[model samples]
Target: MTKPQGFVSKDRNLHVCKAEAAASASPADEQPLLGEPEQPKFLGIELVTLKKIIPLGLMFFCILFNYIILRDTKAVLSVTAQGSSAEIIPFSKTWVYLPMAIGFMLLYRKLANFLSKKALFYTVIVPFIAFFGAFGFVLYPLSNYIHPQEFADKLLNVLGPRFLGPCAILRIWSICLFYIMDELWGSVVIFVLFWGFATQITTVDDAKKFYLLFGLGANIALIFSGRTVKYFSMMRKILGRGVDGWAISLKAMMSIVVVMGLAICGLYWWVNTSVPLPTRSKKKEKLKMGIRRGA
Candidate 1:
């Protein structure tokens, strides 16, 4: 009799998962499917009867960290954009940006096929995180000066600038790029992939009973993110009084994003390494047979 997936031995250890044991034997393997498990400890407080519950906490933490930064990034961008409202183009009132979205989706399809999940995750996400870091110290400070009135005038001449102002054109252009990259952090990272990751390692039953606890992480992130945005706002106001307050705040926010990115990465590493998903049935049997033969 084969044990069901996510099987645990007699000790009823919350962390034990046969699939993880088999999969963890190798370093570079895909995460294993979830199996039936013993009741796991909830919040490390009360011992719950639900099976395969503990490991999913790792997934929850990852989601929490992702939102803590991504949501904050959205707020930061909004604040920055508001501060520089004079520069923003009024194209948002129109549907002119639809073509660009269509173009991006077309490109995204090809890249999804070409890149492995891990590689694709890094390729898309790492750069965005790095951008936040670089933006903090670099692009943001020079932003007001970067797109001069001269360049805006040249763009107006060549691009058929109708009713929009030159500064507005430059601001809109910068914002478009920022919006695409920032949106991807949520779309590709959280909704598309991360949710799938949670589903991959959890059974329907376990997910149903305990998912609410997992969802609580989002609220925690929301609260923490609000505070983070507030702190940055205050710091920018007090410290950046002599200089550009908005620029200073943008930098501070981006730096925080980088730090959160690091924490997320470390949590991801721990999730994969320590609480790995279950491996295939055959692999487990093979390993067991080999061990018995060796003994």
Candidate 2:
């Protein structure tokens, strides 16, 4: 040691290096973390709250819309006419579906972007008005056009040997679209809206939760909507059949869908408006805040 006056002993050199490494590792010795920390609790709470409220609201709206459509249309395919003269009630309606499907798909994509959650809810109001208006303005008068005898005759002709299988399949497919649109208006539209919203929202985990909650609500709606058709037919006798009863129920159901659509659109708007851009600085800040809050 005397010979090397400027040099530290090996033990002392090693000790100094180890002390520096430990100090570097200690956050207390360094500057505070710069960004917000992960807010697991806050996120968990928000997710849970949304999961409960949104699904329940959707389910109620679904039930109402199903009741309306079922009451009005009865959703039955009756073969009323005999032999070559037979007809089906839904014949013309099937032709209308191809166009409606195209329109619906286009509207869905556009509205998913243009409408806020609030506006989407209001958009559904159109359908409500449309449904009742449709019944009074179109279906009520058309009900007179629904001749059971003629329908049967048309059906028999369509199902005769040559056209039987293919014609039946086409009719069934048309019926499927009719039922799908009627019963699933809210669920389907909302699901599409949510898909757009999920892409907008940066939080992948939150999107996952929201999707699952809404998906469950939709499945439940599908099951209930199918079962309710029978009950609705029976209830219609007591509910009355004149324009007023039909109009009122149809309006009520349309209102439900419209309102629910608005809510979903509103939520999308809120999420888009509220969630900040996920830049590196913001993410770091979020991380720091999250850690501090956790501590």
Candidate 3:
């Protein structure tokens, strides 16, 4: 019983194509494992190196703006709840967000069956942008009519720290909704969507180089957000107090938030198209070159 002309010893690669037979003969066993070397450095920080980290850096920039808005929007809502003066714990913030986390996780799990990580990312981005746009342009303006300040003040005596209650505002429920939204965005957007998209684009080797810097980049956004708030306040001053200045400021900030969301989507598109992360089919080819099964 003779073997066929181009048959191989390996069970898996036995049926491999003629051109690829030599390559797939021993996919994972052939490469010599080497110790990590001192990465090439120019200024203590590997400014000039043998790898690409710029795409990760761009992803981090998008995360910076996204997370900053998540932080400040929550801060603004918390402040607004006490008439822009103080904050009240409307039930434990922790308790409020826990069920939200569970629900989001369930939604994401279901969506994962039908959508790629990229699609899930946009699904998250679009709704939030639409909500903020409506808030800035329409709902916020009608807030006084929808949930009047006079009504809020009447409740002040029952729930008071001062002249107003701990949770007294023209749109009391809207403030709480935004507060909860901010929490959900931090959980879903930062931890799930951004990282899920990042994982698709990154390899273990790439993670070693970029993940720390990614964290540092996001934290720095905290410093910039104060300056951003100041700039918007200036915009309000220029627009004039009696002429719906806060609305002008909110609209301007919301416009920038939409742009940041676009930047994240664009970066995801670029990483997927231009750099092209490996798929399962490509992974077989790479394994032929040296990568181990679990490595």
Candidate 4:
């Protein structure tokens, strides 16, 4: 006997469904044996991933390159500031740097309310570049006139020889200022600004893959900056002892720092504008919403 029409149609549909399922499964079942083709990669990263990672690595390289040069230069200037010695460093860290850091944090919080992350970055970094430029060209040249040598002498006498650390810090206040600002650049710019920016835009998977190379870039910076410092150090011999080699080195180093600072800003702007950063649009919207709420 023939089946009813409704039942016949239902049976036909069931067969079609089974056939579709089997067809889907056949490829999945064979997938393991056939093996998926490997993605084309460069230096262990796919091209798509490299596009995101390269700019970030280059930015890190510039940041760290300037940081190391400034760090080494600051140490030299502070320690060799006539009356100052290594003893002043601990005192400066405790008495000077800590307070400056706290003040800067408070200022940064206020700035965050008023600015976008990109604007905030430029605000923070431009001042550092300006300060270093001014120090190298103008302030260092006027150190003898600006430094409070007589007051430091009187204070030292009053406090006795044991207070030389504090006295030296006061005597070469410009150098101390440079030292504190250098410390802040490392803490604020490198650690807080650059890494914070990196973490905000990068996904967990991308960060894991990219951060290792970012670290590699920093290591390269260390080597490069060391060589740069050594080459400048050896410049004194070529120019003779009479030409004030340290001054020349400071000017040259600051010039490089300024150039690198500009490079960093350029890289940051390009990444913000050009890269297809994840959640970047969301970040901008949130920033705008925050500003509106603040207003």
TM-score per candidate: 0.63, 0.44, 0.66, 0.79
Instruction: Please give the RMSD to the true structure for each candidate, in Å.
Output: 13.6, 11.3, 10.4, 6.6
Cα lDDT tens digits for candidate 4, 46-68: 66566667777888999899989
lDDT of 1 at 95: 36
Off by over 4 Å in 3: 1-52, 81-87, 90-95, 148-171, 238-241, 279-295
Against the unseen true structure, what C-alpha lDDT does each candidate score? Answer: 0.57, 0.47, 0.63, 0.85
When sorted by TM-score, best at the front, the candidate numbers are: 4, 3, 1, 2
lDDT of 1 by residue, 1-295 (tens): 8776656455365446665686667533644358855444566432432333544455455455655655556544633562244324234323334555455456555566566555655565577778767766876566666645566666667767463443454544455456445656665667655675567556575567677887676676677777877777677657634687766677666777777776655655556655546552444322221322321
User: How many residue pairs clash in each candidate at the backbone level?
Assistant: 4, 40, 0, 0
Q: Across residues 163-200, which tens digit of lDDT does each residue of candidate 2 receive?
A: 54334434343333334455445444434433433444
Error of 3 at 215 (Å): 3.3
lDDT of 3 by residue, 1-295 (tens): 9876555466446555664866666733554448756545655444332123565566567666756765676676567543544534345264556667677666666666577667777887778767766776776677666666666666775667563433353336566556676677676767777776667666676677668887677666666766787887777777644697776777787777777777777876776666645454344322221122211
Candidate 3 lDDT at 189 equals 68
RMSD over all Cα atoms, model 2: 11.3
Runs of candidate 4 with Cα error greater than 4 angstroms are 1-48, 280-295
Best by TM-score: 4
- Pairs that collide in candidate 1 are 5-35, 5-36, 6-35, 19-278
